[model samples]
Target: MNLLFKKKDTTMKTIFLLLLILIALNIQLTNAQPTSKYHAKLVALDNVYEGDVDLNLYGQNPSLVKMEWTEISPDSTKKTIHRVQYDMEAVLSFIIDKDTFYVKNLVDDEEKVRPYYLVRKVYGNDIVALYQYTSKEGVKRIYIGLPRRDPYYVQHPFFTDGTNMYTAFVYFKDCDALYQKMKAEQDGYWFKKGATDEQCVSIWKRIIDEYMNCKK
Candidate 1:
């Protein structure tokens, strides 16, 4: 009877220890992952964009592209002006692939008529994409603040594949978190020179992996 009692106590202790270890691991995992709000945002965004047309096709053929910048006057007013020229025919040809495109809020001709293909251009190692938002003053603003080098290196807060509507929206939504991860993993600095397609894609794949893992 004494031996059986001792064995029962030992088994109970072992089970208790295992439960404690499992609890600790759950806490660690919860702390390591992103906040509940971010996860909720991801879920909401994924659902919103799931069935939309894949804009990747537009980026595949970027024949005509243009760059733009923001100009703030002394009066504290801001305006986005075209920094480079564009070919209307080239822009039109690209858009002709799809019947039509629309923006949620058509504030101006720029955002209304302009297709993603014309506004987001990829150079050797850099991507310049138009970012538009409604300002506090109730005006639509646009700008392309691209880095001279591989924007990914500096954790540029824009998508490298902005021409892809879904991907770009996801990048814009999670840019800060993604940038922090990239900066921490890549020696905490941005690349000083242009990056090749292979290089950029490899880095992006890692970023995507990290994101998906966290989601899991």
Candidate 2:
């Protein structure tokens, strides 16, 4: 009788342990599911798509964009989840939360094209744009894109020392004059020691507006 009771107790403990393990696995799987959605515009498609969008990278370069969304039929009777992948070149832009991102072609010193998402667009138009990119390693870079010119990296004036100061103002072929003008004004106090990030962004917007006016 004593042996039988001991065996029963042991079995009960084993069952409880197994149940706990199953519960832990279920929780982990639930947490692993993707939940965030984005608004995306593709170069090939005219209509905008609202979905869960991911930038799939291949060896540190963006190879494609994966999108998943549910479509409801016209009759409102059926809903199907659709999953699609687009080549990196096919994606024009996407908005996650409230921030907009554009596809930027990053060219190396050897002139090879490496595509990455421009994380932020400080200023942009048909003719020229200023964009910021954050790499996988969390390094941030600023870029200026212009017609007939390769998208080139520029030293961020607010974040770095004023070395290569003119690079930040190279929005046009004749921007040398504008750079000199801003330089005289201390480049909107960007070179000031211990300037806050918010202050720097405000100064950049003002300078970009001034530069854009010169192009008009």
Candidate 3:
């Protein structure tokens, strides 16, 4: 009986040690996580459009895409103008096969990022689609921010192949978490559907300006 009692005591001690460790880890995560200054994140889309396709025929998404910056700033100022510049390119192909598309979504093959962000262009609150797609199949398979019910795998996915191909690079933080943020904050932006190259550069200029002015 004494032996059994000692064994039980040992097990209890081990369990207690584990619980303490878990609590410490949880506390670390809470403290270490990055915080944005603004309670209200400004959700915006800056478009760099590729070629358009007819839905009557199925194919991959186009090559040579564009990117825009959306911010959730701490300050509340309407119509603040800032400039950003995106001047990086890489050697890789963004292609689609029939209904499926493969989007690296990076400037080049060599660059690396942690894929810390997600962009969901919504027709409305209920409607969300990723950047690439097949017109006939619609956005049924290829979307980043779809609300999945039981199978949580459907939400905030990267490098997922389906009706559309979604891609991500290295981000400063976790990819899925960043994606969840963009999906949740659903705010409208100055979306330029098919702006000219010059217009697009101008938009980047605004981003650079804002990014510099904003506190890191």
Global lDDT of each model? 0.35, 0.60, 0.31
lDDT at 61, model 3: 22
lDDT of 1 by residue, 1-216 (tens): 999999999999999999999999997666442211111010121122111122222222122333334566788777645344343232321222332221211123222322232122222112333333333365533433233311122123233322322333244234567556444434321222344434544454454455554445
Instruction: Count clashing pairs, candidate 2.
Output: 0
Which model, 2 or 3, shows the larger lDDT?
2
Q: List the residue pairs that clash in candidate 2.
A: none
Tens-digit per-residue lDDT, 23-67, candidate 3:
999976664423222111121234232222221123222222233
lDDT score for candidate 1 against the true structure: 0.35
User: What TM-score fits each model?
Assistant: 0.23, 0.50, 0.21
* Candidate 2 stretches greater than 4 Å from native: 1-45, 56-62, 73-77, 83-85, 108-112, 155-208
Steric clash pairs (candidate 1): 153-190
For candidate 2, write residues 114-182 as lDDT tens digits: 555454676767566667777557776656565655455543332345654445445443666667675
Superior candidate under TM-score, 1 versus 3: 1
Tally clashing residue pairs in candidate 3. Answer: 23
- Deviation in Å, model 2, residue 202 alpha carbon: 12
